[model samples]
Target: LQKLRSGQDFNSSHQYPQLLPRRHCGKGLIDGEKSTPSATLYEFPWIAKLFNRALGYNCLGTLISHRYILTSENCINFYFIPDLIVLGEYDNFREPDCQLEDPTDCAPPLRLYEVEYVVRNHNDYRYRIDLIRTTENVAFEDHIQPVCLPLTSELKHFRPSQYTIAGWNKNSKNTTGIIQKETIYAASSAECQINEEHLPHNVLLYTTSHENVANRTYSGGPVGAIVPSSERRFVQFALVISPVERCVVALDIVPYIDWIRANMVE
Candidate 1:
């Protein structure tokens, strides 16, 4: 049994490398000639301060509702507190820095909110050793809304090919920091699972580099699938970011949404 376990570990480990650089820049409403405004992306006021202060930075999250934002558990570690600004309809590239000077005055169509609660998955891999769990719901101070949790039974029905991931990760191999929007299609679980650059055990071995993985600043960003609504509106909220081993493309496995509802939501 021990040998089997060891072999399983080795096989899984060999499937992925410790790092995989992002090769494609995704297309989105935020990109292109007639792009969505930068304000549409969520931003954190306190984190913006940290960014201006020259502390290390990362990006990870998605807007699930007009009010609620969904992101990875690790992203909370990057901030000192939950005071954040949701950019709703911005376009200027330099607006993030300019808004930092006067957060109230910045005309970036920002909706400032505070995190009220945070819900995290109990099965979060990071908890394997420390058992230190985080809450998944980060409730807001204002009326910013909560994202609808995907049904547990529906997770298997999710087609990996039908999803998109967006973020502002690094753009170069040598440079350490930059904030830019990029997107990529979802690769198959088997593809992700078999890739030697993202094995589970290796992810545990190299946590810090994992944070720096993706090509255009993914980190704590959102991986979502657009589900059509009866009313003709499309709702997108697929995965919340989680830490993984490899640096290949900063794409950590999103905890199964069903698992999140069972463990985190009230």
Candidate 2:
């Protein structure tokens, strides 16, 4: 329920105080069970589904603040902006999705918000960043919260061994309505530039064990890693801005921390 204001000293550590620890980051309803192809009912609470009833287009987004949703440039390429963004959703077909172990333990219903406006970083050519402003500020709770952004320069450049990508695999024939998460291997920016000369230098390059792990449907989804600190909160490193053929390209969040903050407060 906190609002990010202008002229405040930016610090990633204190930005999102609602973020849970590493042990509860992606844990499902069950104490020890894990959500595989189907992410636990509330495993990734920041994930949002963008949709336009007129166009019938769907894309994944990350809830970055009480009123803003971060997505990719391609997600807003349509003629009209997405009219709706759904949060805290597990399965599209189920209402109050429950755990497999005990059906009685269920998650809260999905939160739907109407899109008020859209903002795109036109200057960012390498990996474009986009933000969707909701009509009202969100109420943060157990099943709804914002993901941490790389507010400091150190976090942006810090590369880990692996990154996590989560989205609704609606485009895949093998996958169902459940949210899916996969580990993508991080490739050095230098190596990525050498392999893909067309890509700009500001992006984070990644290679998946399977090419189909991240496709067009994952556009605007979050590419994050568990911050290696006492807090151990999940920090969104980038957005799935482009398509995945051989190398997956993303808009690195480190470079756009200032832009994101300005937009959030404005």
Q: Which candidate comes out best when scored by TM-score?
A: 2
The TM-score obtained by model 1 is 0.45
> Which ten residues in a row are the worst by lDDT in model 1?
1-10
Tens-place lDDT per residue, model 1, 62-110, is 5443233444455554343244434332322444333333456433333
User: Residue 24 in candidate 1 has what lDDT?
Assistant: 12
Weakest ten-residue segment in model 2 by summed lDDT: 1-10
TM-score to true structure, per model: 0.45, 0.81
Q: Candidate 1, after superposition: displacement of residue 47 in Å?
A: 15
Clashing pairs in 2: none
In order, the Cα lDDT scores of the candidates are 0.33, 0.70
Compose the digit string of candidate 2's lDDT tens values, residues 1-266: 21212223346655534322223342223212463655666668888888887876567898877788888877776475788888888776678777656799888888889887787776737567777888888877677777877765777678878887877665656657777777787776564454556768777778766556545367788998877776567788888875465456787777777666655543
RMSD of each: 12.8, 5.6
